[model samples]
Target chain A: MKITCSKSNLVKGVSIVSKAVPSKTTMPILECILIDATTDIIKLTANDMELGIMTEISGDIIDRGMIAIDAKIFSEIVRKLPDNEVTIETLDNLQTVITCEKAKFDIAGKPGDEFAYLPIIEKEDSIEISQFTLKEVIRQTIFSISDSESNKLMTGELFDISDNILKVVSLDGHRISIRKVPLKKSVADRKLVVPGKTLIEISKILSGEAENVVSISYTKNHIVFEFDNTIVVSRLIEGEYFRIDQMLSSDYETKVRINKKELLSCIDRATLLVKEGDKKPIIINIGDELMELKIKSQIGSMNEEIMITKEGKDLLIGFNPKFLIDALRVIDDEEVTIYLMNAKAPCFIKDDAESYVYLILPVNFNSAA
Target chain B: MKITCSKSNLVKGVSIVSKAVPSKTTMPILECILIDATTDIIKLTANDMELGIMTEISGDIIDRGMIAIDAKIFSEIVRKLPDNEVTIETLDNLQTVITCEKAKFDIAGKPGDEFAYLPIIEKEDSIEISQFTLKEVIRQTIFSISDSESNKLMTGELFDISDNILKVVSLDGHRISIRKVPLKKSVADRKLVVPGKTLIEISKILSGEAENVVSISYTKNHIVFEFDNTIVVSRLIEGEYFRIDQMLSSDYETKVRINKKELLSCIDRATLLVKEGDKKPIIINIGDELMELKIKSQIGSMNEEIMITKEGKDLLIGFNPKFLIDALRVIDDEEVTIYLMNAKAPCFIKDDAESYVYLILPVNFNSAA
Candidate 1:
């Protein structure tokens, strides 16, 4: 295979596929990226059994052939090359020669036939959505996914489509985040459990682009997302996701409105004294005209009070400070409303405009008073 | 003890002294900073048995007393407080109460008597040096200090002073860096081995100031540096330093001059293929007008040739690419001159100005032709 491509385009294409390359595996071929050269284009693909990425770049192809080279080494070499055209040619002995300016590298390549085949997506069932909207949905709900794989269902976020709205929900039993965005066209209703890793990769790639559209397709066990000249596919987890709406409280005995920045800063200050294994809990005491936050650990203790507008009854609630801070960062408003049922009930926090809702389970602490 | 001080000044003072606080040690009191409050000033001191730091800030002191508090917790509280005047008061139970605006913290304190007493400077033999010059000298030579404590003498930088000239030398057997500066006044000739950690802390604190002068004092067993209302005392490492100048060769068989940035970039690209657990040696072959660098590892290999102006006999040398990059980064000139005696001998690299010099030992490779 022989091809000549712009240095910057090849760097970007190789980097995107390198993220899916397996670092350590029993199968040696998994660490290599398959490169194919046609008359006018070069395709690069890499997979680690669970997820696969393929990208194509326009280049001047001298010959038609295929070879698989070490993904990490190729990416590093391409990143450091000077701004010029890079020529890669495969020899009869299965060694690839890469030349740029005065530098040349000979890398041993494996036969492309040994690489695993990637899933093929059908264009008939694919749906189009804005990359910016999808990125926002992933960022809002991905953080709430459970890191543990023992419960396969909780480790993935649930993507449910009904009527004309697309909803994403994630929960780790202690906290849940739900986000919804309206679709432009009506399609068949579907539900899929997308793994957190795939969502993270999609988010990273989408962060650089503007408001471009993304094409998505899914089968029973696999999903694919196509954007620009790249495609990403991942296997879906098989399980039943919990009904998160049922877990939220129906009635609240107390409600308080506070500045999001002030509350976030207060929680951050209290977290300094919260011990690691001693349960990092912060107590929030609501009064007639003020709210006081307190945290006590083995080393020290801190208290911060801020003025707030409270209604109904005065109450006290204890929760992990980190959870509060994470939820506050996602809300797109200056002021947030917190609804509390009791000391042990889950607290629902949302902006007064009610764009996004977050539910956090409160910890039962003896120091809540 | 009670005192009120500006928030910015308190944060800066506490941060400087906190660097000496021991993170983990057998003596619990070593982790605390002693606070001494007088009518006009407040002093903070911390020591880890090997190094001590004391910083004083002007404040309104209500009473004269002393107490010790955990340095980490105190610094954290001070950092998060609002930018306003802060009041720190000690209770009868030995708890330090800190209040700033609406935020309050009560930190547990230990007895001030349990803290270690810092060493006192007894002589008038002190030399004044600008913080800017001192910081530059430390940054250039500190990276060459030996990290392994097995060779106790090589772990510290040798500081030699004679009249108005000051010189610093550091060597780790394989590489050496030397820096020299002229002082304003003449002083007695002295030599001291200052630990690497002490120099790092001093550099960090002296980063922003432009005109502040550092006053240095050395005794038989300790070295002290006083600057900007802060004093740092470190115990000298007892040993005789090696005579590095004797190891340098006087004549060279091959010489080359090249752009520092171009050479550094070439070395960085070649090192990407160096494998772990194997000696990371890069071969350099000098021909009529070009230099070729090559490295081979299990995963892949790379070759890069750069243009240079050379004279004398052609030569080949093998050395660790990381050391060469380090030496290149320290050069202040755009062009660097490299002199090589032979493939097995040490290589000398420096700029034309001769303000600094770096010596790198070549690695012996049997495969080199």
Candidate 2:
């Protein structure tokens, strides 16, 4: 196999596919990137059993062939090469030569036939969403996903679409995050749970341009994401998703409207007293027009006050400061309204337009006892 | 103690002295910063026995008192405070209250009397040099200092000043680096070995502006650095420095002039084949007008060529690529001259003005055998 490509094209293609390379695996070929130049275009693919990424790059295929090169070494070599043309040639003995300007590296590559191929998915039902909206939704909900794999459903997010509205939900047993976004085109309604790690990788590859869109296809066992010149295929978790609708509550005895930035910074400041692995909760005392947040940890204690517009009855509640900070950071609003049912119930913070909703369970405070 | 200071001034003072706080220690007092508000000026001091840093910050000292606060929590609280005036006061029970805007924090403090003080050094003699020059000299030679503590003298850089010239030398087992700088004012001749860790911290604190000068003073057991409103005191390593002059040689049978950027980049590219804990040396083949660098490791082999101006007979030598890359990175020259005596002898690279000299010992190349 022989191919000549520009340094910029090869680097861009390698980086996009490199994310799917298995960091640790028993099979050595699983750590390689297969370069298929059988046609006019050069295609690079990396599959790690769970997730696979493939990208097509523009290059001249002097001789059509295929080879699997170690991704770690190849990426490093490409990144440091001069910004010029690079030529890759594979010999019959699997000895590959990569030359750019005055530098030449001879690396032993494995046979492409020994590598595992990406699982094919039937793209029958597909939906379109803007890249910006997808990235924002992932950022808003991915944090709440559970890191444990014992309950497989909690480690993945439920992407349910119905009546042209798509809602993404993730919960970690303690808190739940739900983000609702509208689809650009109407398609068949579908529901699938995507692994959190795959969503994180997809978010990194997306652009912020609202005009660019990503087409997502869902099958019985696999899901595919296609955008630009790349395709990502990830296995869907086979399990029943959580009934997030039943967990969400809108009835409240007391509601308050607070400035987003002031509340975020106030809670963030209180977090300094709470150390890692410590279950310290921030207690909130709601009064006439001011809300005071207080926390006392083993290290120290902090108290901060912010003005708010409260209605109904004044109430006191406690919550994990990190859960509040996470939701507040992703919320892009001048003012956010919080609804509290009681001291023991979950606190709800949602936008007036019903586009985003955050529910955080209250922590028991012993100050009153 | 009560004091009101700007957030900027407080943050800067805390950050500068916080570097001296011990990361882990048996005595917890060493992890605290002593805030002394006895006079109009507020002094912040942190002493970890080995190194001490104190800086004076402008603030309104309402009453004369002193207290010690935990460095970790105080730095965090100060960093997240509102950008307004902050008032800090100590209660009768050693509970300190810090108020900024609507946020207030109560943290426990220790008596300042229990903290260790910096060792006093006789500041009778001092030398003046720009911080830029001192930082440059440190950056040029610090890489050669040995990190292992088995050999106490190798872990420090020799700072020898005499005849209006200051030459700094640091050498590990493999190579030696020497840097010479002209001092504006010459005082009593002195030679001392400053700990490498101390020099690293000082380099970080020094500003790049050459006009800003730092006064350096040395004593029998301590070294002091004073600049801007801050003072740093460190214990000096006591031992006889190596006889570096005896190892220097001027006679050479082969010489070459190469572009600094090309050689550095070429060597850096060749380093891709060398892995951690691997002892792969880059073999150099010197010819009439071009120099070729080659390296073969367990992963692969790489070869690169660079055009050069050669003199005398050709030679073949091998050396660790990291040693060459380190010296080449710090030298701010467009072109560099290399002088070699034989295949097995040490190579000398020097500037035209003799301000910098690097001697690299060659490795045994088995490729020829």
Best by lDDT: 2
Q: What does the lDDT come to for candidate 1?
A: 0.85
| Residue range B75-179, candidate 2, lDDT tens digits | 999999999999999999999999999999999999988989888888867888888898999999999999999999899999888887888999998899999
For every candidate, how close is chain A to the native chain A in TM-score? 0.95, 0.98
Q: In candidate 2, which residue ranges exceed 4 Å CA deviation?
A: A367-369, B367-369
Residue-wise C-alpha lDDT for candidate 1, range B157-217, written one tens digit per residue? 9998866778888999899898878888989888888999889888888854558889998
Model 1's CAPRI class? medium
Write out the backbone clash pairs for model 1.
none
Q: Residues A186-299, candidate 2, lDDT per residue (tens digit)?
A: 877888999998999889888757899899998899899999999999999898898888888779999999999999999999999999999899999998899999999888
